[model samples]
Target chain A: MDLRQIWILYRHEVRSALRDRSIVVMSIVIPLVMYPLLLWGTFAAMNFVEGQAERLTSRIAVQDAPPAHRDWIDSLSGMGGVSVSEWMDDEASARESVARGRMDAFVRFESPPAEGAGLEQNFQLRVLYSAARDRSERARSQVEEALVLYRGAWIEGAREDLGISDPEWSGFAVVQEDLATPEEATRFLLALMVPMLTLIMVALASFYPAIDATAGERERATWETLMTVSASRGSIAAAKYLHVATFGAMGGLLNVGALVLSLRWILAPVAGPEGVGGGGLPLSTIPIIAVGTVLLGLFVAAGMLVFAIFARNFKEGQAAITPFYMVTILPAIFLQSPDIELTNRLALVPVINLVLLLRSAIGGSLALGPGLLTLASMAVTVVLAVTFAQWVMRREDVLLGSAGAGLWEFLRSHFLRRKGKA
Target chain B: MNREPVRTQALTKVFYDESRGQVRAADEVTLSCSEGEILGLLGANGAGKTTTLRMLSTVLRPSSGKAWIMGHEVRDAPEEVRANLGFYSASTALYPKITPRETLRFFATVNRYPADRVAGRVDHLIERFGLGDYADTRVEKLSSGMKQKVSIARTVAHDPPVLIFDEPTVALDVLNAIELREIIADLRGEGKAILFSTHIMSEAEKLCDRIAVIHGGRILATGTLDELRETTGLHYLEDIFVRFAGARNAGSAERENAG
Candidate 1:
């Protein structure tokens, strides 16, 4: 592309973008205002959740037990997180307690066994749980485990000839994941939000202004004068791309700034305040995450401008940028998945790579090679997109607002006609 | 051949609509205009006059034809062709925020004016176009006449060899239109080849050295007023135009009636 013409288009795009109030709000103001509020809200929510989880105590009702099952029921009442209450033969009364949410669960025992028969001949216990209870599901599972332990011991005593060692193996085996610092958890959450915000800001700042300056001008027929000059079209496109990219980059940077300033506040409950030993999250990684966020933001903005130029007018330009919004939001949704991580190959997946990289950086274990590769991949992708955009600029139909014409018509007529044989 | 400033052969621009098939905006049109002359292009609305001017100016490439502007092929050497021409039309929009001076300077830079001469070029055009008074005013706030003048200034700032104008005075008042005519005359006097499209027969009669009457993307006839008068046996240029264009439309009407 000719640098001079591109510069002219770029300058106009940037100037127009700066003048738009909506673009400015979406790109800069919204992030600046929203980040702090969101951070404060998130921290508040996390604190509330932690408190609720810790204070929870489940109340369960037990009924209809034979004398042989009495000891087992008593053992369950002894468990720390569960409060067991006895109920008479009326199952309806116990169920009412569960419905009222006064009791998390209720248990009932069957008929008594004959003398000289085993406890298996006696009775089974039934546990009824309240759906409203948050930890009622876990409490119910623990109750079942207690019953199984009793049954296993009875079966082992009955089968003395069979060689069985570990009867408690199936009851409760804890599987522990590597413990992450509170900072890591906070970074995980921010990774989802930061990339999406950056993408959105870039798109808003660049798309409309780029369209207004280029396609909009052309549709108004003013571009004829620009094109009639000695300037090459390539140069004009280059200038325009540069101008748009700068605006988009600025928006991304502003969002990054907002996030950096609000990071500690937003993640305080999860990561805690600096110098307080409860949270392992470091507030210092904010700058590192900001760099990656800003780079990704620029790429998004430039790409949006290139795509927005395909629109026939300002209104159509807005419609055309819908996919870009989806592109940004889609990756943020992926970060909510517990399995997603910052792997080497994932760094090449466009916007997701930025989020993943930022997550790893904030979490304090980013691999340098993957981070650099992600940057390189983004640069290469940007280059390819820009090249395609240059070709679109060269196309008379695209420049003239005829880019939306049916593909078959373009192929059978314009493209085929250019090939001479058609 | 005279040094033709603009020439086209079989120039056709077909606009395809999904709902409606191919609409021939400009169809199989062969034309040429020599240097240092004023060629008036006359056509009704949707008759492809603007499209023709666009192709000649290298703004819109022809769908399946060839054109040369100042000896440079528009398709192959668009930049060279663009470098050699100035173009203006009423449809041309102005940048809303920037002043006329800034817009012109920006265009001048893109047009590759020598750094030493860029300032002088902008100044000359600003003074010559009478935009000196409002050169620093944002174009969005400028009067229509003033904006028109700025558009003209922008077009002429680089002083190319050819100029194409398409109904540039469409929205202008009588006084502004006359001033624009005067400006066109002045530019022509400097020996720059000029092509202008207009529906106004009087303007074409007064300003054009030669006239090409076009209808339905096809030129029906072209000549000096005297030549057309001799051929059509009509006193006024409008009479000749009406006789030929009216006959073509009437014949099509008759065929449709018969069918």
Candidate 2:
């Protein structure tokens, strides 16, 4: 196996892939443009919805309140987010109005408050609203808040009448503190999304090029010519694998960069001004993530090339590669759960280990041992996949497009036949 | 006497078919092509013409046999064998996205042609094959004849001593086929040992210095045209082939009946 020959084959594969417009569009353009647009669109939509919600005014009606409650109803009208109106119908009619969206909510007082009940007042208040309607729910909460304030004022007035001036009688103060830094919280949120997105983009980036290089050659009837050349099958397969791995790595990097840049705006409201980058992963973690991306890219690319070569044509290659893509994605989705961590056992798994390692690395908590383990595991798998690809290429029936047994059955028979000959 | 550029001893290939048990795609066949000689492998489709050519080119492994290209054993030294031989089939295609020049350069580099001589050799072949106008055009945009010209140029880019062509004219128009015959004659003039397979009797008659009649994975006869005619008592090559194939079929039927 000549390294120069491998380089020549690799260069040709890369040049061919570059010339293919579909591969260029799928790998580079989509990652660079689509992610930013998708992120910007989502953020803009959320902002618009929030603005609309804030400007909305909800109407509330009072039902069956005695004339003596006029002052309290007038106070409710003075508050914001509500337009209190007279209820000329029964309780059912007020509820029907709320359900129909004509009124946002209704406050039904079962009976007028006892004349001088003071602190022991025992009156039933029912707040009716359509839970399915956002405005109705908002209006009900506002009305409830106003009533609580009014009750507080009444209690304060009674306390003044009794000449009680101690402020401690209001309630005990409850203070809350969040232990997480802005970075840690942002990392938590990004850990769920970034890894999955990166894996998906890597798969997409490598898919077309892998299929184009292997099965595409066969479909174009160029495989036989390629095989007859002086280059060893191992060199040829390695060159193709390098071409696919380069695309996969580029995709992974571009996706991470795009996600980082876009999430600054996309997650601003959720993660604050520092956003996805703020306090989350340190600048040092970038190199670690970069390394992980390359390893994962190589792993996935090798696996995809092996499967793609089994197919006789481009469409058949796509069909053959879909299940592999799905299998890789399943582990990524499983890794999205915060409960799954980078443990020794998990580090032994292929795709799952890479995702976990990336998540840990990006979140700035990657331990040295497990990170090394994940890298080593992926490297071994890539080697095995590439070896298998080289073996497949040497088979006469496969290279010549002759009808034969399925790959596994053929390999089994081939090995047994060799053993018998020996 | 010139050295033999291609030789085989008991070359064979067996394919296992679920319905037919074991099918001998190429039986224990032995033949040789010497420098400055053109050996036309004459056989109909499915008569092991391709299977035999493929084994000699090291594209398919012989089940139990030895073959050599320019004295390099195919199985033991495939890279050396490939370095010394050029194989072309009618179905062989060029990379569609690459230009003809680029295709030749790729082949030259892979075949380890001297780095300094690749460009000059490629240019000479381009002019020789009348591909100057489409040398820089993507192969997918080239006409079928032009593409075949590029294919043949790339096959011989390293100037190997042995050339194997399998049905090279099967897809070519009459003009292109005639052009290919001229190219094969030129290669022979350059003292390259050329073995090509063809079912077209006239093509074999016009181009082959010697003919090897193949049928059912075995060569029935091999000699000069007159020598073959004298042996089979048939004047035309087609009638000679029919007699050979018919006799083999009758023998097989008789054996089946006896069983």
Candidate 3:
């Protein structure tokens, strides 16, 4: 309860943690550069794979076509990345060849032949290809593209033959337009990704600091020294919990900053420069993101400390903390489903609610009532996590890791013993 | 309020070790140290030296009996007991990243030293522990000897009237061990009640104003070196320790046989 003593211990923990390489790397360096570097790596990998696919030659064969289509078949032989060949076999044989991978695709002409070799003629064509093979699929698409060009030219000739001066109307014309601004388009996707990324990054950032503050102290033989100080156990717990939580929250916000800055580039591969706009989140939602991130840090950080303190050594502490980190962030991942919205019932759920709150806030559709409800649930969860951490600090088994006991047995003894006493 | 700076009445601690079943690490340990006196708890390893001192420092709660530090009962007012006591053992360590000056200032502030006087107290501890040369360097970068010096300085940063040294020289070289002995003697000279524990007979012979021989979690005998010699008709402190510890072990064997 002594604020001054807590402040003293808190400052010391911060100063020491800043000097730790593992903590600094996770809390600062990773947040600042992890998103951009990972996105860049992914972007480069995609380009490499696309280039390889582009270089692959797709083989196609023309079989049993009438003499009039010989010119089109000959032109296909000269097309880029298409090695077209003449097939002397029957239509069924050509199809079998395509299926057996002897060729990428086959083309055949059905009977009920054209009435004449003129613009008014009607023809039946079927393209054969495997859906599983990349080359077959590509050949099919290339054949379709070539057919489209040929049909356009045929349409003009048909108009001339029919004595129709206007070539614009191909029966009916359809025009499409999008009403979304570049920023709005960017925000739509950002709303889905930012919340999940925030949860994961913040959870990861606290991983090392939590272990260093708790089990690392015991391993280095410093916990006894710190415990000998005049501060009450509650004060020490408060200071340690806040110190680690601040690091986690700070890492998350920095990651958001880095992510926003990298947004234009991350989306550039899909949406050209102008398509994604400046890639900034809706400015109005910053306050909501900030408050939600802080509450999340509080809850997640204490969860990490509780797990870490239960372990006997640095290695065991890491093993204990990894699962808790995954568990906290895993719930937020479910929010990736666009079907999940900030409904009245969903807003009462803990981390899922925060994700919904952030998603709604970013999408510019957040209702005040749901937003407040989400924040309240997160606050209540934070209070519980912190109170549990403080109470655990008073336990001798927790303070001095349960000697030689399995993690479950350690926990069972403490909780059961305390309950029985009460 | 207790007049003695350090006092205890039949202190005991029982640990539940799976292999050993129930072990009494410290059994009804009664002892006291007055101001300007160094009371050496002379015993071998696992003879309840550390456990007894740990109880007095309020780091471990006793299963039974009571202890006081500067007039504050350990169980009722642990924070006050910690504020008035300085505990230094081989296991107590400093933060490797902070400078010695910062370590001292932090300890002083947290131990409830007045805000304005913290700086002066830290400066005094630095000089007292001879930490002037590498005081600014990170403790990890300092040599082992220098790190030990910082550890000693941190123990007395709060200027507590009661100080406990529990096998502090166990990990130190001979030169650093001598330096620490001199420091303990100097603290006693300044009227601080000191409880020094060690298995080394020469250490107790050279420093302790009075010696308490302990064995099997109990203090077998307590007296000045001359007083003990007078009772046992022995000149050497090692022989005297054996006389007490040996007799206690033999008595346990006899009781076991009787059972």
Could you tell me how far off, in angstroms, the CA of residue A118 lies in candidate 1 after the best superposition?
Answer: 30
Look at candidate 3 and give me any clashing residue pairs.
Answer: none
Q: Tell me the DockQ of each model, to 2 decimals.
A: 0.42, 0.77, 0.74
After superposition, candidate 2 runs with Cα above 4 Å error = A51-173, A263-273, A277-280, A401-407, A411-422
TM-score of 3: 0.86
Give stretches of model 1 more than 4 Å off. A32-192, A218-225, A262-291, A302-307, A368-373, A405-422, B1-3, B14-24, B63-65, B247-259
Task: Give the alpha carbon lDDT tens digit for every residue of B1-259 in model 1.
Answer: 4388888888888886667878888887788877778899987787789988888877877888899887788889988887778888876666777889988887677666666888999998898888878988888889988888888888877777788889977888999999999899898898888998998889999999998888878888888888888889998877887898898799879999999
Query: Judged by DockQ cut-offs, is candidate 2 incorrect, acceptable, medium or high?
Result: medium
Q: What is the TM-score of chain A alone in each candidate?
A: 0.62, 0.83, 0.81
Give candidate 3 misplaced runs (Cα > 4 Å). Answer: A42-67, A70-141, A151-180, A264-274, A403-407, A415-422, B1-3, B18-21, B253-259
> Which lDDT tens digits does candidate 1 get at residues A266-288?
54445556422333335576666
For A1-422, candidate 3 gives per-residue lDDT tens digits of 89999999999999999999889999989988988898788878999989987799988877677786675676666678888776787778877888888889887766545564453345666889998887789999988877777678777776788788674555576667888888777788888988998988889888888999988898888998998999888898999999989999998899888887776667565667666666677667888898888888888898999888876678988998988887888878766887778988888888888888999999888998988988887898889888878887777656666533434666666677559768
Cα RMSD (Å) per model?
8.0, 3.9, 4.4
Q: How well does candidate 1 score on lDDT at residue B253?
A: 96
- Local distance difference test, candidate 1: 0.73
- Judged by lDDT relative to the true structure, which candidate is superior, 1 or 3? 3
By DockQ, the candidates rank as 2, 3, 1
